[model samples]
Target: MVTLMRKQFIIAVIVAALLAIAVTFGVKYAQQGPTLGGDFTLTYRAESFHFAEKAKPLNILYIGYAKCPDVCPMALSHTAQAIKEASEKERSKVQMIFISVDAANDTADAVATYAEQFNPAFIGLTGTKDQIDAAIKLFGASYMIEENKKSYLGYSIAHTDRLYFLDKKGRVRDMISSPRSSEEILQKIKELL
Candidate 1:
């Protein structure tokens, strides 16, 4: 009788452990936001500034102002790190496009510089208020201007700090709501590929 009780207890513990793992992964997967898709035009700042159709499937469109204080930096850093770690084949198929939501300060040139600073392969994008607004509306991203009057020439943008992932079809596949572990993002990129 004691042996049977012990066996039952062990089985219960195993089942509980499995359930816990499932719930943890389920929550993590649920946290991912919308995917990217549909037809949209965005200006990409590369060797020379130019407009391009998002006709590709595997793409990453990161929307953040160049002057973001914390979240933007962290997200960009992690993304760069993850891409750097991706295999050559994966890296070749993936394109990272950075879009600046700050119209006042982040010019196409400035945004380009910011993204290149992280990864030269990273493509920075900026455009007129109208253009940026269109992309924001299309993606349903949010941003607010926080004026820092106390400091000398101080102001910052509080914007959604999420990485928008797009599949090869130029559709949003998934959104990484926050900075993710490098390994996890690499795995996701592989899955997307």
Candidate 2:
């Protein structure tokens, strides 16, 4: 019995030490921030748009569908307001990217029209399931289309409401999850630019 107790104590100590090491590493990882976000290619204006090659020095990217009723429009409007508030010099260096997650209903033309409504310079993009999935993975964004026969649209999409802020090199520098006003967004843009 004594021997068994000793062995158990040793095992418990070993487990505790392992747990401590794991917690330390986890904290460090978080402190360093996420090592995600990158540029991705998709269809823009019925042509291939390589983000790294075509994007401006600063970019604001959002993932949603054109037919979205509330969240998407609100996000876009807020972003547009921010762009409009910026000086022409700042605006010249920045661009907005609207990526449609609802491929089933959002054709390239549809997304383009909707995106342009907010800001004529805003670039709308969408692609095949695989292409979109790859792009979404790069940004850690997600979306799902749900059937809602009872609703007028017959379906709805649940997606992340986030604006990814990218720097000149097409690297994600920050994310504006919910900006109280366009000024808040513009502030971030100015800082990054």
Candidate 3:
């Protein structure tokens, strides 16, 4: 009877250990966020941009246009602040890519100038209508452009304001929706790094 009880206790301990290991792994995986990716190519400052070829830097992609009056500016400001808050080592490992949704109005020079207003390090990208459409589809983002004669830019573009954080491997690891404080964004970036 004693030997049987000891064997049962050992089996129970083994099962508990296995369960703990599985739970640890599951939690870690869950923290990594959703898996989102597809072919995306664009032109940044007249240069070709391709994620697959650039293997090392963590890319934080923001989809908006230069003409955005509120959301895009705020988002870009917050992102720039977050990047500034990161340690120099951590900052060097990250890249902020702003893709213009208003391909028609946001010329390469315009996009570059707009992005540089936030941070000179920020890269601005835009493409032809078809290329922009393909990139939007790949990133699962939505945007709508409407004529606004009263506005200074002659039009308005409504687009998804969320920031897509892709890891060094070029996999979309996290999608930050809603506005987060610079500190909060920095923490999220650190975790992925």
Candidate 4:
């Protein structure tokens, strides 16, 4: 009986040690995934916006202006369709976000409306010019603003076309540039899911 009790005690100690090691490794893995949205604050069209509130969505941040002639809208539409085509379980794990590079024209309400047209769950964000510029710089996207004194607009921005994919843990994993098929983008997003 004494020997049996000693063996059980030893087993318990081993189990405890294994659990501690697993927990440490799990934390390390999560920390190493990606650090995407850690230092940015963007204003979106929502009743009340909080990044922590939308935890279940995969948190995709797209940087473009509402006035983008082609690339931005095309990419956003593709993203929406891709999410729709995903398996129900996979689709539920994604949240597509549009961040406006043109603060002068794109508003939270405008972004929200446009995003809803594609996917109700999609989010649109806009802020001050400085805020927009800061976000663009952080993402390393390049842009050129053209001044136009016509059509009720003073200026417009033309920018590089790129889509950034962030995992559910808010880490940027990969980027998809424009001039690529939506199918290709979908395949990439599917892998991340």
Maximum-TM-score candidate: 2
Order of the predicted models by TM-score, top scorer first = 2, 3, 1, 4
User: Stretches of candidate 2 above 4 Å error?
Assistant: 1-31
lDDT of 4 by residue, 1-193 (tens): 9999999999999999999999999999897864544345668764545446564546667787776667787888888877787788887777887877777778889977877887888888878888777766766776787887873467777786878776555556778878356677678867877
Model 2 per-residue lDDT tens digits across residues 73-122: 99999999999999999999999999999877788899998999999999
Give the lowest summed-lDDT range of ten residues in model 1.
46-55
Per-residue lDDT of candidate 1, residues 48-145 (tens digit): 33324543447777788787767777778888888999989888888888888887788777888898888998888877777777777766787877
lDDT of each: 0.75, 0.89, 0.84, 0.74
**What is the Cα-based TM-score of model 1?**
0.73
Clashing pairs in 4: 34-171
Q: Quote the RMSD, in angstroms, for model 4.
A: 8.3
lDDT of 3 by residue, 7-57 (tens): 999999999999999999999999875567655788877788776765456
Q: Supply candidate 2's per-residue lDDT for 27.
A: 97
Q: In model 2, which residue pairs have backbone atoms overlapping below 3 Å?
A: none
Overall local distance difference test of candidate 4: 0.74
State the displacement of the C-alpha of residue 97, model 1, in Å, after optimal TM-score superposition. 0.9
Higher-lDDT candidate of 2 and 3: 2
Alpha-carbon RMSD of each model: 10.1, 5.6, 5.5, 8.3
C-alpha-based local distance difference test score of model 1:
0.75
Best by lDDT: 2
Off by over 4 Å in 1: 1-36, 46-55, 151-153
